[model samples]
Target: MDKDTGKAFDFRLFKRLMRHTKPYRLTFYGVALAAILLSGFAVATGVIAGDIVNDAISPKDADKLLFLSLLMLAILFAQVLSQLGFNYYANWLGESIIKDVRISLFQKMLGFKMTYFDRSSIGLLVTRAVADMQRIGEIFSQGFFVIVADLLKMLTAAIAMLVLNWRMALIVFALLPIIMIATRLFQKAMKVAFIEVRAQVSNLNSFVQERITGMKIVQLFTREEIEKENFRGINEKHQNAWLKTVWYNSIFFPIAESVSSIAVALMVWFGVLQNVANVGSENTGIIVTFIFLIELLFRPLRQIADKFNTLQMGMVAANRVFKILDTESHIDDLGTVEKEDVKGDISFSDVRFGYIADEEVLHGISFDVKAGETVAIVGATGAGKSTIINLLSRFYEINSGMILVDDIDIKAYKLSSLRDKIAVVLQDVFLFADTIANNISLKNNEVSVADIEQAAKQIGVHEFISSLPGGYQYNVKERGTMLSSGQRQLIAFLRAYVSNPSILVLDEATSSVDTYSEQLIQKATEKITEGRTSIIIAHRLATIKKADKIIVMDAGKIVESGNHKELLKKGGYYSNLYEAQFMAEEVA
Candidate 1:
């Protein structure tokens, strides 16, 4: 939601927003109907009051007074019915529109490549989806439709004044330009205030969400006081942004009220002038009717500035939402091929990639793994090992080369088809706050609880799961904080195994585990990789000693490729790494 778009009400953006309501045009028409009916009621109210004054009270006609009073009551009841319908449908439509918008946002995020998420904030996106979305809904419930209805009422009242007495109508109309100028100024000020408010809210949400999610680190490092100070600054800025809108309201409302009162006083003075000059007979009925008319005319103008603030917020929110909707960072699913399975052969040929432009992480590295073979990739922290796995899974696009599965370009397979055949267990295992079985199967009903249990049994973690109070039904809580790191890894391994993937990846799967957990993980790894082609990325040299082949990487290039014995016999990078890294284990 940028502030310097020049045109405050961009027609293109509004047109796009209105398209979301295309499916609910009936609701839109209904609101318009209410506006028209309300305007008619406003005119009728003035007319009935004038009639009661001139035709009944002045004449001392009791029967006429009761009839007109009852008539006014009926009009009031009808206006109330129209108002209820307007409020209900307007709010319902707003909610319905936001539901669709939030869903679209989530679906877009789901399809985005990891690169987009790498540099984006979780909390900022949440604010966009949840908070900004609500603002857009308020455009209907509290902003645009309501303003339209009130303006319609004002117009009807003005027309009635002109019909009743053209000269007096011109007197009240003369005061409008003053209030109109104030409203224009108020709207501009509010637009700027809302932009700042939205930005501050996003910042606040990002700061709070990050701090709360990483509260452990904050406490571990005793950064609580520092974070509190930071939060205070943000909260102050947020409060200030809101107060700007309030400050403008303070200035604008009184100007509108003064102008309204001046217009009424002007009309009363005109009536007395007519009496004094003998220009016309005194018309108390017209004066009283015009009093009601002035309120209808100026009251909406007074409140329109406040409603415009709501509208401004919605426009700003729409800009932010449309920014996401217009993003093209999602990976294209251009592949025409569909496959139920693959032969498990994988290759990366002259592949190059980077998360950021002009900064290569993988430098045209090439590797191959045969079907059913256990291949291990050993590398230092920045050797692009994980990047390679990411490319294989199509989480990123290769810069200038090709990745293939079973001799077919990986891009030739549809994304879902390709991903279904491969499973990854990363070092940082993530689990939803859900039952163990649901986490393992990821809510895929095709993989039954029995299938999950059998897979866990095969991986030798069934006994471990059975020990928990709820066994497979145990809730792991957010990110599986309830379990130890090693236990979370076990769950990841079980999740991978149950998918029965043709290709399995364990990226530093045993890195952060106790010896006992590592043993269980190793045993599970052996069982899971029995038939499927597995790629193991590990720092511990001993973990991959039994691999059919080992590829050793330095920086972004492969420096050695061989079995453990051959790599040791060659006295190269692998031999030196083994000596420096795992010599203690070798001694043990």
Candidate 2:
């Protein structure tokens, strides 16, 4: 919600946007050349019309009139062709530029740290990548090039008017200062209005996207009427933001038209007086020409204000998009190690970290997991158990201390190389709107159907999947909404298993599943963790009794570490926690 009340023309942002058009230089210049030609054609038409009145109509020469008519037709045809070239090439260049920009934006988002996504809205990002991109395209397709053509026409018309009759041109130019002042005010007012319009557009998109995504919650609580009222308020604000722009246009255009009419009136009035006083040609061509000349001069002046609005909006969008591109949120992947295989031995030594600076979530946490060992971490909520997984995966960097994999500092390995060896499944699983096989393979075609089937079978979910209507090809819909919560967790398990990682981390992976799914998941867990190092984060203490070690945490500190029987005998923090939090489940 940063309000950028920038100047009417942001030269820096303009230059940045222009850089994107560099690759399409040939097409860009071709469109500019067409704009120049269009201006020439427009001027020629007006000149020819003046000639028709004097050279063809005055003498009543039929043959001459016919020739003049054909000539006018020819000029009209050329004007049409020039316009076609200008319109088509401008749009083609614009679309090409936005296509490149969208790709870059998407790539930047992909490289950003998880913290960036945590603090940003998905809908706002979508608006930047999609709707704002189209506005940037408008700068070329309808705003910048069109304004250039109009300005050229106006300039040529002014020169022609002065050359033909200076006195009348002076009279017409008298009213320009009035219109110019209004237009200057219009540009400033519209810039502010359009910026608000774009902001409201982002707000509306964010609200609607969140509401639709969580429609079930509204329905479940029977709060439909309240949500509807909330939506109406947002929609009203969006409408009002647009109406402000419309109001500016409303005040500007009528003043522009009225001033144009005054210019036309003064031209005709002066022309008649000059003809009556015997100071000009009796043929009436000059007077007739002034009428055409006046329109050519002032019509573009009128339209230019509107086009400038488009240009300003485009610059605003470019500024926002470039801000994201320039953000320094990407994790530094400077590590030179490129090992394709890692031994799954992880160690955290005096690691202190936080999602925010100066507020540590893991206070000097330290632990070690040997290769092929299974360790379970049990803790109260907010005890920093999940932060351990985030640190191990390097989704967020630690503030102080070292995390090592196979005795080498984890930061010394290439990010992809380090992550390739580890896999994590969270309690709340996410699936894309794609086929079951595609979800399991993450759209990696190299993981074949046979491989997916084999992994699913080994993980004990193949029978459940085969029972669905499309089996392996079943569409899970958005976020796997078509599947039950336990089913979604099972899918997540299968997905992780197919990656064949040397290290696996399950964060509350079995917390939401039913009895049957839990049994199947437990079996799948045994198969996947047979030889690989595994870390299981569980709230249910019974789930991890067989783990080689149990680490109990409280308030970001590890209070105990031992075998299940040993920890029970200690009767310290772990014993008390088990009695209060897990004893009822054990009894049931």
Candidate 3:
């Protein structure tokens, strides 16, 4: 859960959320008008009822009462139609606004740097996209409509009561200050309680996602009981939060109702006293009408209080949503830069970078790949091999360094242009839950079937795909979980080959594949890197032995560099790693 204890309600953020409603301004106005008209007609019916009672009971005018009854029915019918219009328009506006917000948020999230994903949780992001957006829609559709209608009803009722008898109106209006004070207190309490509820909800969501995704690992380790206990703890926290909110609301609603009841009592006593002192007879119809109007006022007041609770919850959700939308992506596209063909001459000069501040991962590392050279990087885990490729692709920015392509700073090129020239295949390949052909083409859709088949053949996965029931149309599950590790890697290779990039990066690409797949991948790699600047990071010496140049890294520094035979002759780190691996194989 995000620590929001010290966070205060920001009015500026509320204004930002409201800005999304700008596109539906006309619809909002129409809904507001319809709500006001509907509420007015509702209040007027009480007045008509009073007239009918006075005529039928006291005056004994049956014709007058009959006509008034029909009039009331017509007004009620109009009120219903107006209410339906208000509801339909309000719903349309709310849904449209939320749709725009969700789309904009998704676009912003996609632009965020890779580091954002490393630090953020998938469950939390998904919660914002799905759950939070829905909360916002509820606020607009239900809360907004209720608040507006209640305010209109209250205002109109107060005016009508004042016209009927200013004394009774004053008596009733006295409750306004008391009601305001009560609502203000309830709002404060509900805001804090609802915020707690939202936090607990996020925590519960995160826990459920973790448990489900890691269930296999839990079962393998036989730790189901421990996982259940952890889930129970989170569930109890959510339950406690809800209980606290209900307790606050339980106290608040009755207090508001008691205040309304007190106002009603005062009005009735004063009204009866006035009738007896002056008129010498009870104007029971007037008394009843006054009571009906007061009920109308208090009904919505109670509803408004309830709506306030939901509105506060939605505000909490909006704050979280806006925080994500407001995040400034560290990587931005400078629109002034133009896309152009890249020569593939890559150079890093005095490059320094870090994932976190003040702890440099790459310290003044410098290297150059002459137009179409194949550079192999061999290093132990966490030696910054992947970091180098990440910086080259601008998936991350260098802290203090200059990367140049064709002797020009790569930053000067448009990000899309820079990335378009590069292709990468990592050991962990990600294939969408799509057909094998669609996965390879990445939804370009314009790539011909023949082109896909040729690329698959080049990567030596053509026959394997043909063996499947659906051939090229064979669908892979999310992350290609249905396919073998080697098959996924081969598809990744085909994806890269089809792009025909100027720079190729294969980071432990063949590490997970079997020996037969590895041989096929080696052949594919040679063809893909034939005329491109290639960087291959591999633990296996066999994969890097044929490189034009080899770089051996240790502790974030280049410990050795040379051709395969030259490095072997030097008898340094590379030669030692090679001999050690071979000796281990011989012993086995």
Candidate 4:
């Protein structure tokens, strides 16, 4: 699913992921200190046991035994405190780092070019931003630090064994290599399995999200059975990927348990022989301590496999998340100019653009709209009407030539400032699950309730809004489902009108509405386009007959330019298109 899927761990990705921790270095240092304390406390527990057996319990010295018992209890207390601190701070650091990472990822995506979003999957991105970030957090909270602490305990235990009885320790250490070999194989296999798991998770999420968003289409076309089968196949792949990890775990853990068991048995066998041969009586305490030491050493070796799996999964997620972070799809905002006000004079001088490289959608098109003038563009479906709107807002960069506003290149103005001066009403209006006033003013503090009401009044839709249950406070719900298409368009128009923009664009704004709504929209249009630079792109030529100029587009080129009366007199592209489409609508 991604490069480095074969790697059990990636140090590069790990380092990059850790960089987000710099801001919380104090918490990181505190967690590190706690981990070291926990390891030390763990080792002391075993040594204290030996002291109790040899110095107190063995000789039946009641006083010494009581003191050692209290000492061991105190060590237990310290260990618990250290563990508490370790778990808290490590998890705190993790949550903090992921919070910053998530925000940075969102900010980066916010600046991406429209072309980047045009082809990207929404569900896949949601996975990267939400699910993958938690995996990265687990790397710190439960993965890396836990593995290090466990290994530390093991190392300290190993040294204590060597000091107590070297021969028995060596015998126990012989089986260590066998466990290591198995663990290494397990890590590699698990890494590959986790990669597949993540890939399938993303695929399933994308499929379900698309199906849910377009559930209407599926039901309308009667495709539910087919979709269910597709989901089952994707879900099975997800399950099988996890089952592979389970299979590897099943084979590996039992082998590890057996080797450790044999190691413990060998230590006892050797210790018993030394005592029977009249060796040092001190071997009694040493034998008991070795029991604790062996558990410490081998148990982490077994448990490390689990933590390493988390580490591996986190690295895989980090790799995928970093790819998005490293993508260079942002539209350049290098322009130093910021305008307080803009004149709405617009000109596209031989402008050309393609959503994809070398596949031009608008080929060297040219047009001009002077301040306070209205221009209409009539085109067939794919004649590049929307592409012009995208270019003017700097959502997509022009491939060649210049787009000027007030005779200055659009690129010369700061992107935000340029967009602030324009408002667009598209054929499809999108509203959030927010109040109607919010959808209109869009939470701009400058536009108040009074302002929205006044603008709605000016656009002649105030009466429609006031008729609703809560008037401007009405919750339109997601995509404005509570409202009709005509009502949504009225909201869109009032939204655009309230902006008081220097330039305005209406893209098929009046299509797909009832006659009464059309009448209302026509009145709104007449008032809103009064003194603003307006660009109207429509298929219905009847809507723009009074426009000062009309440009006809076909297959990415401007075929005719004139007023409606002049074009009809010339019997050109606009006249022929108008005749055909108008006649068809009339017949219908």
Separately for all candidates shown, the number of backbone clashes (residues 3 or more apart, or on different chains) is: 0, 0, 0, 0
lDDT of each: 0.90, 0.89, 0.84, 0.91
CA RMSD of all predictions: 1.5, 1.4, 2.2, 1.4
> Mind giving the per-residue lDDT tens digits that candidate 3 earns over 296-315?
88878888888877777777
Worst 10 residues of 4 by lDDT: 334-343
Backbone clash pairs for candidate 4 read none
Please estimate how well model 1 matches the true structure, expressed as its whole-model Cα lDDT.
Answer: 0.90
Q: TM-scores for all candidates? A: 0.98, 0.97, 0.95, 0.98
* Candidate 1 local Cα displacement, residue 161, angstroms: 0.9
In terms of lDDT, which candidate is strongest? 4
By summed lDDT, the worst window of 10 consecutive residues in model 2 runs over 1-10
Tens digit of lDDT per residue, candidate 2, span 376-432?
999999999999999999999999999999999988999999898899999999999
- Candidate order (lDDT): 4, 1, 2, 3
lDDT by residue (229-307, candidate 4, tens digit) is 9999999999999999999999999999999889888888888999899787777778788888889999999989989
Write down the RMSD of candidate 4 (Cα, Å).
1.4
**lDDT-best of 3 and 4:** 4
What 10-residue stretch in candidate 1 is worst by lDDT? 1-10
Which stretches of model 1 miss by more than 4 angstroms?
1-6, 276-282, 584-588
